[model samples]
Target: MRQGLILVVFAALLPVVAASFLQGQSALEDARKLAFERMIGTASAVAERQRDPFVIGQHLLLVHATNPDVTDMTDTCDAALRASLSSYPPITNIARTAADGTVRCSAIAFAGNINLAQEGWWQRGVSAKGMTITKAPIYGRIAKRDVLFLILPLRSGDGRQNGTLTAAIDVNYLRRALHDAGARNAGTLAIVTRDGKVVTDSNNALAFKPAMGAEPDQPIEARDKDGTMWIYTLHKIYSSDLFVVYAEPRAQLMATAVAQMRAGMLLPLISILLASIAIWVGTNRLALTWLRELQNMSARFAKGDFKGDQARFERAPEEIAAFSADLHIMADVIDRRNTDLTQALEAKSQLTREVHHRVKNNLQIINSLLTLQSGRVREGAAKEVLAQTRARISALALIHRLLYEQDNGYDRGEVAIDNLMAELCLQLRSARRSMFQVELTCHARNFPVPVDYAVPLTLFVVEAVTNAFRHAFPAGTRGAVHLNLDLQAGDAILEISDNGIGYSVTDEAGQMGTELMRGFATQVEGNLSIISSEGAGTQVILKFPLPNMSITNAPPLGSVPAF
Candidate 1:
């Protein structure tokens, strides 16, 4: 209860804290906007100043290019290059290159005769018709330090390239200027190239580092290494592929928010504390104990133990008492219905057993009459047909006997398939004991067979067995007949084979038994195959789908001579 109240108090205080925090963020944003504008202006002014030295050098080269008398490339441009270098000290060197890949003039006297045709700066300048700036500062082969190149192509009278004029500007000069501006404004500044390279930063050590998360066209806010909030703004430099970054840190940004929220919530916090105490005491005395007991009772109800005689809810609130009474009424109704349903199920089971018993008795009487008629006939095909018919009838009668002996008649009474086949084979073998000495081996899996499936299944096996008994072996011949019934992959397989005189598979005569076996198989949606040879034994196989409860109609119990 105390934990819940504490959480409630925390939830109530959230909006106040959030409002104060948003207010402080607003102030920081305003300050950042002003700082970003100032930094951008500073960067623009610095970029213009940095371009001056290169512009002066290029102007000096343009003067000589327009003069007609100054046809000699090196001698005419040497003095001008020296004069420009002396004026702007940041420009380390200046050079004029001829069309034949020769550095014709230089501010340094010994810098002549250096070939610059293969350099990236020379290639780009010769192709560019106007002023071009290097995308990245390059290390000068002669200057031995990083330098930025500003190239101006020298065009002749026909606007064709004659040679190139190049100025090497010191990178340190721009870095120092940016550092001074950052120190004065209490922020950091960096110049980044378009390809995410930080060329220089306010701290001299951060050169060539990966650029921070600043898009070239917008401003973003983030935190620095010391958890100080900083806003970064990006400004693209005019006439160049470089971006200038301005970052300002608001050291006490969140601290002011936290302090304001604490001061404003002083009265609210005390009031919440007193209210929480009163709520705790009142709910404890009025509802908490009874509510806990009610929760336990609900748990018991969910588990089907709805007898709530032990619940002491009379002293609780009127609503709680009324709810308890309703629960008790529902439980009483459920209990009485359960008892009445059990008694009805018992009565229905007894009636079903009695019905199956009478059916078995009537089937046995039919089998007895067939037996008496077979005995009166001479030993010929007529008597043999009666005997086979009687065997089939007896097989159907055995199914009902098994169903009558079941413990549960309402659960669609199941029979063990292996046990059923074993008992059937034993009875069939005993009936033919005097005719021939035969052994019937039954192999099957034990599976719960529903009554509907059992009826058709038993009749199908009976036809196959009797067919083999009549045709496979002759009179007074001892032979072994094997029966294998197994359940595999949701199909029932019944196989019968006999080591007796075989017949030709091509012979189509005496097909009545074959047709009868086929009909029984089709009734169960099964397939039948027979293999017979002139001298070898015969084998019969029947494959059918597993028995299900869909066979509501009882199977034909009499002989199937016409199939």
Candidate 2:
């Protein structure tokens, strides 16, 4: 129930949480887009400033190329180049080279044997009629510094190349120009070549190598050599092969937006947490407490305790109070019904026992009559028949007596087969004629069976043992009669064997006993087998299934006193 309440609260608050998250994400995206635009603008400004030095150098070279002193390599040409270099701090040197690659004039002094014959920029300049710039910065031999060169072709009247005019712009001056332009920006600024070379950087501490594949005017994130993340953009510098890079730390760029988003989301999260707590507490107080009390009362009722107090639920809700009242009424009804059933069961059990006692008394009377009749008979055959009849009657009487005699709490109608067999063996021993010196030994295990099963089983044992007593021992031969009842698998085995002079089945005297024993075995759904020979002893074995009932209360094997 508490979990259900929490689920309800969570479901109710889920939409608010989702909406806040989406709104914060949208705000964050907007902040990032604005930051990207500002950084692009700053980069464009720096690119423009970086282009200025190259543009100024091109214009100066064009002007100087037309002067007579510079073209003719007059005595004042070196002085003229020096004056131009001093005026533009970014231009490190100005020089004029002859078509054959000899240096005719230079602002910076060097060995006169130095030639521009094999230089790539000079060869290209001599071939082209227009101004040209170097692809990347190079170390200037005359200026002794890293520089980018601008070249102009000097031509004769027929348009043949006369010589070339070159100006070397210092790399340090380009870096200063980049810094001045982006000083107000938040991060590093740099000028890079088309092939990802860093020509000049405002902050050398960071790796300013911009990606060559990056599109211009767009921002992308990159990690530097020191594992710092940056958001930077690239802008081309005015048709030149150089690019300006503006970069800022990613954390700084998104800090304000992240803070705002977190501030916006905090309240809703706290509200959900508090609401869940309230629901949990409120549900326990209002409903679960009363439900728990009702549960306790029901458990007690299951254990037959119906004396739980109902007044304790008077202050509960109307539904709970009414439910408690109903449970109390139910408990009363069940208790009364249980008492009535118990009384009726006891009365039935007593009547059944009384019936068994009367039957046993009547059977014993018949047995006594048979004994009297056997005593009067003079013929040997007639006396033997009467004695056998009396033994059969006595067996029946014994079953009834066992049924009624049991004071144990188990059903009185059921007979313990082990006890019955032990008693039967005792009776058989007592009844044996004095003429036969026969010993009887009984070994049986306990099995409680209903009267229906007990009757046939007891009779079967008696008939088998009696047959062995009469036939197996002849002329008063000393022998033993063994009766055994054992349990194996799910079946019970009853064996009656004797060590005496055995007789064949074809003999007239044994036929009747065999048929009678077979009938008894069929009645109890058992299989009967007789093993006998003319000289050896006989064994009558009866195998039958035990009744399907609890036998835990039955005594263990060898527990019953055997005779």
Candidate 3:
């Protein structure tokens, strides 16, 4: 029970814990992604500021070089460049040079002409014949600082290059922008030229070095040498060939997320634990205790103890209280029905006893009337036939008397064949041979027959014994008559034999008695055969199948043909 309660509580808690855990993980991932985007946006804003000066200087130089009637072109262009340099902090130097690399205008006033057409930045600008941003910051001989140049070609009215406008950007200013933008995020930021060279970066060593596996103008996630996760987000500046890259440490993102998740999950986890404990304790006290008591009551009911007070079930939990009430009602119904059946069975028994007594008395009166009738007749065949009829009538009366005598409850309407035959032989001898006493003994086994079969079988036995007493012996004859009834393999066998002078095989004088015995055998569904010869004792045997005691009615007499 304790284990079951624990399992149920854990089952309910598992989903809540899992959902909270998943929610924490989702919040952490969202925060990390948001931080990644913020760093990228910061670097992009700085890159835009750095590109503003080149855009302004290009406009100024193009407007001045386009005027065909300007006599002081150098002074006009030089004044425009000086004004642009002062206004923008990232612009360090601006110059206008002819296609032959002779300086036409300069922010610095030089005494003589300086040729710069063969310089690396100048040669690349000449080949492009348009605005060109340098791949990496270079040490400028004219400006005397690490700088990048934006050169725009000045086209004549005929669309041929006349001179070039060169704007030099201060690398320190670019570096400072990268540093300040990255400092806000507590990570590294860099601006790289299109050819993978770092133009400016927060880290000094990383400046002018190749970017590590970075694609231009794309967001990427990678790891550094020390195995810290870094997200590198890139934004291309619009007016120049530069990429602004922002990298934030994954560990810092995770630290912030972890703190958030800890704050978010504390109360829910504690509440789940407390709720699980409370449910476990509450159910054990309020529900499980009542259920256990009800289980014990059911066990007692199985053993036939249905007695319980109504207050006991009323005090049970509401879930099973109605079930308890129904069980109590069912037990009461069974007890009342049991009492009713017992009284009915006792009344039925008394009625059966009275019926048996009345039947035995009525049959005895018939037997007595037959005996009186036999005495009124003379000593002839008529009188002999009356004596046989009286004997058969007395056999049926004795069966009812035996059934009445049965006091055992199991054998109430049954006759024990052995005891029935013994008492029957004594009664038959007294009814028939009052003049000479015949030694009669019954050898039989204990088997019960219902009253229906017993009546016909008893009469059959009486006919056989009476015939043997009358014809098997002569005057002054003293002989033994053995009556046997035994059970063998679901069959009953009755045998009556005498040690007396027997009749001839062809004698027809006792045909009536023989036919009468055969008729009684047919009525009981039995086989009767007589064994007699001159000067030999007679044996009458009857064998019949015994059915269950519930089969009270005999089969049709025609069904058992006499053989």
Local distance difference test values of all predictions, in order: 0.69, 0.82, 0.71
What local lDDT does model 1 show for residue 367? 88
If scored against the real structure, what TM-score would every candidate get? 0.47, 0.62, 0.49
CA deviation > 4 Å runs, candidate 3: 1-47, 56-89, 95-121, 139-146, 154-165, 183-236, 243-304, 309-311, 318-330, 343-563
> Which residue pairs show collisions in model 3?
none
State the TM-score for model 1: 0.47
421-458, model 3: which lDDT tens digit per residue?
77787777686556365677776666667777778777
Better TM-score candidate (2, 3) = 2
Quality of model 1 by C-alpha lDDT: 0.69
Error of 3 at 375 (Å): 19
lDDT of 2 at 226: 83
Model 3, C-alpha of 98: deviation from truth (Å): 6.8
Candidates in descending TM-score order: 2, 3, 1
Q: Of the pair 2 and 3, which is ahead by lDDT?
A: 2
Predicted structure 2: clash tally: 0
RMSD of model 3, in Å? Answer: 10.9
**Candidates in descending lDDT order:** 2, 3, 1
